[model samples]
Target chain A: MVSMLALLITVPMLTAVIAAVCRGRFCRLLLLSGSILHLGLALYCFNTRIDGRWIGLTSYSEAILLVLTSGLYFAVCCYCCSWLKAEECSKKSLWILGICLPLFLATMTLVILSRNFGVMWVAIEATTLFSAPLILFHRSGRALEAMWKYLLICSVGIGLALLGTLFLAFAARMGGVELHDLRISEFLNIKESLNPGWFKVAFVLALAGYGTKMGLVPFHTWLPDAHSEAPGAVSALLSAGLLNCSFLGVIRFAALAPDKVGEFCTELLIILGVLSLATAAFFIIRQGDFKRMLAYSSIEHMGIASILFAVCGIEMTMIHLVAHSAIKMSLFLLAGNLLLACGTRQISRISGLFGVMPANAILFLAGVILICGVPPSPLFFTELVLLCQAPLWLALLMVLLLFMVFAGMMKNVLSMTMGKKCELEIHAAPAERLIWVPIAGLCAALAVGIVFGVNL
Target chain B: MNMAIDLVLTAFLGICLMLSASSRLVHCIRLVALQGILLGVLPLLMWNWSKACPGAEIWGAAFVNIMVKGVLLPILLIRAMRKAGVKRELEPLAGYSWSLLIVSVASALALWLSRSLTIPGVSVLAIPAAAVTVFTGLFIIVSRRKAITQSLGFLAFENGIALFGAAMHLEYGFFVELGILLDVLVLVFVMGIAVFQISREFEHIDADRLNLLTDTGEVK
Candidate 1:
């Protein structure tokens, strides 16, 4: 019971080391077995209670993120097996991918499970370090550029978060709280005792810091480039898994703010939320790269998630997070398929995905429909909740941006998915057989929407 | 003891100034290493040896901090530098004089700002120095063009944060400190590999020069 989270984090790390030394086929089998074991542990912890000094499932939010991360990793694992066989990478490169893939999972697990702010910051930075190598899977020049920006920008952002954590400690000392460290349970115990002035600065610095990793506006410069260049499975994990960890970081700090500053914290999130929505709205309009378009969609949904957390609270935000994960998982995986069958990332260069890979095209279209907050999806309900709770002008502005983004995305997606057949390179057979991965993702989103139906 | 901390910080702040003003990447790297050694030593000076302290353990951790920050890390960056082959930040977006001037003014503002933030029971002098060093690190990162120089900028940034933590006497315990150290080591190593590759892939490591991906005609 005490070591549940530790077991979960360590299993993947062990998988990574063994995979590095094993044969390629054994490595693929290890990834599959490893993720299943992780999913089982996550499910077990959800039903029972667990706690430790540095790691635990202490809240509803932590459990939700853990499940989402593990579920997404399991799905991405199947896709990765297919991805590996499909792409003809050298043995050394394959070993590198094998090691990075699970280590990335382990670090992300650390981020979600850490009960202390300092440990959380360290884990988040480690995620950046590990995932950067995953982006180098293709090793193309464009991929290199994207990986560099992703590493450098997110590191700088997490750096600010470290400073913010330090300030929070200083605030505790100034406010006369007798805490030994930056543990979450202890911080909540002395919540009212923290100095408000420094608390506010710490919160803002953290928001901006993790906000960079979350890909909120003004800090989202790395998202599109990285998402477009990274392989399909990696992008799926990135959008579905990594961004949520960053959001968890923000929400964890926000949870520590005193009651007096509670409203102030929400106001800051609302402002960044609306700003992110606006930035994504402006850019998602007429994006040329299909993958980049999907990347923008992630920013849009993350914006809406922040707003959901601010206006409707954590329960609604968790629902939106799960829904966004499902949809993005499908969208990115299907985008990878489209890239395979179409042989081009630009929307203008390819058409008639319906004519070639009809299953992937349909999944991609469903993902688009879900992400745009259409009926039958959880985002639809979450956005509606935010719109009703938010002030009048903010709601109106959100509606406008959502519509503009919808139009921009559908315009590009329609052109690609529904035209005459283009010349096909046809290197997509392995992925073709693994369509169940993304298909399961979409179904999971619908199921979640149904589950979230009356729970709130 | 306070005077010693202040003296180290003063020199640390001066290195940041020289870093901002210097155009040659090698010279800047040497300054970053010097700055790092000072930060490593600052923590040992700050550690409170209250009664019955684990003197050997505490001292050993401090020594590791000094060795890792002061020596090992600089050697890693220098090797990567030798591999990356460029030595000067030519035509940085912000010229050396303007950049140095901006850093100097920002340092003054940081000094003024630190006076108003009353952190009790610890030397406050390192606060302004850290703030200024952070500003200078950020300045060098943006102003300089070489990928290697960005590494130097990050070194300064990491050093500044470490210095601030020491100044405030904020201890995250030995395990967390070791973990953070390991993370930074991996990060710089990854960055070193990236710089080496960036040089090979682009045939030049000017970060700004690698701007092929843009949002133009993206989705307007």
Candidate 2:
């Protein structure tokens, strides 16, 4: 029997090729079936043990990333079905997403399964390549520009990651470790022998490189544009799947840091996280494009997650990712619904979403409440812990930033969802019933958040 | 052996400096290709080759390096350039003289930086040369106008990393090298398509000017 891990990686890639060849209906079928099957694989692999070299290990982070990726992908695929059904996408775009979506899934799964640093870097790079096309789904010049920035910036970032991995390997090699055994698991055991200077350099490069992918402050210029330009489902996948995958790389490298280097790494992440939050706070306020607003919020949430990972520990960080992924996916999908209903994505242009689409408006409102780290949401506790971890001044500052993000989001969400009835023409198909996928997602997020708060 | 390796690396550094100053996209593409071929051959000279068996991994990596970086990538970039009708790089953010001076400064800095952190086996100059190439490659990407040139810049970027990786003689380097080469191949291929679309849509591939999407959404 083939390794379930091998199947996990290859299955979506196979579907991608098939979907590209098949016509319209068949393509959608392939997407739906492929994702459903992939989701099953994710569930099946969740607890099952596997053994081998290089790709054998399944750490807590990898497992969570895999499940989140597969689950979010399945949700996005469900949304894509309804989304495509309602609005007639260009054949070119449908084909592009059809091929890229599965390829994206495959590469993401590959990234999760690889225990080797080199394999993970390659998989991450491949993910960037596959997902870049999805950003061009609309064929708009703006989308083109976004895709170009994404491709170029991410390529540079991944190249840096490669260099980091090489440096890490060099550090290990200096300890008389063989090059072929440059698995991260090996590095952990022999870290004492690794040169502190080179190890620090490796960690720094890995942070910056993977941090770029995760949309950290300095390297986050590509995130908002890529997120907004891509169709809603792609945005959700990028936010939920891609970012977490990059965080996995960071988490692994941070794991490799010894005592002194570890402090430097943590401090680095903490400072970057605060800067990212500041960036998000600055941009999220009154941002006109709803999609772009959501994109900025992603940066904000990632900032929170980064700080959590740096201070609170990996378990908390993982929970934050799950909660954020569930809530953010719901929000972006809802935003997609809004985009379909009101021809424009501009917040100012959209009014009385409550009157226009009642179901989505409520879900959108609920999503906003959830995302803003409302009292009951796990994020509230997460934020509280982050505050506790930071110095008094920085904590207060983070609180202010979080408040700004919440205020800005609420201002936009309220006006859009609860304002006086301003009738806007519904341009796309009525897929109001399709809200079930995100609804389930949000409810699950709520349950998890409640559970997380108790567990904490 | 050290002198020969340093000579190749110095040549690599020289090409990187020239690349920073070059304005013509075709010229840049060819310079990158030459750098690629040098990258392909450097591994051959540096790695120990026994008469009994020269090792397939070495030859395969070298062959893939030359073919992809030297031949495949340049052809893809050039064809994209011609198709996009992007000729000489026009009005770079930095002027030619300034770009040259900055690359030189970057080389000096890299030379200084690598001196403190030396790997015992690798050539001393190899690390600095790789650093200069990476710096110069990034410089071209940011400072240049055309998307094609940016793609060429990206290729050069990969070449620099490859130069360093090859010089290190990393164990399992062969597989990693092949994987990276394949990635660069697809990256350029996709870039060609993007450049074509941008040119067709806007009739120009000026990367900086391609920025229509902004956060302060002017209700378009």
Q: Best candidate per DockQ, number?
A: 2
Candidate 2 residues B1-220, lDDT tens each? 6788889999998998889888887888889999999988887888665554458977888888889888988889889988998789879989999999999998989889888876678888978988888888888889988888888888888888878787887654567567767778888999999999999999888898986888764644
**Candidate 2 clashes between residue pairs 3 or more apart in a chain or in different chains:** none
Tens-digit lDDT track of model 1 for A1-456? 758779999999999989877845476889899999999998988865565668877888788889889999999998888877777687777777788889999999999899888899999999999999889987788889899999889999899999999889988987987667678888988989999998998998999999999999989999998988898889999999999999999999988989899999999998898888999888889588889989998998899899888888898899899889988998899888877766688787778877777777778888898889887788888888889999999999999999999899889888878988767565545557768888899998998887776675
| TM-score of candidate 2 relative to the true fold | 0.96
Each prediction's DockQ against the real complex: 0.57, 0.69
- Give one digit per residue, the lDDT tens place, for model 2 in A75-168: 8888887778787688877888889899999988888887778878888899999999999987888889999999999999888988888889
Q: What 10-residue stretch in candidate 2 chain A is worst by lDDT?
A: A49-58
Candidate 1 chain A: 10-residue stretch with minimal lDDT: A422-431
Listed for each candidate, the true contacts retained, as a fraction, are 0.59, 0.65
* lDDT for residue A349 in candidate 1, whole number 0-100: 74
| Candidate 2: residue A410 lDDT (0-100) | 94
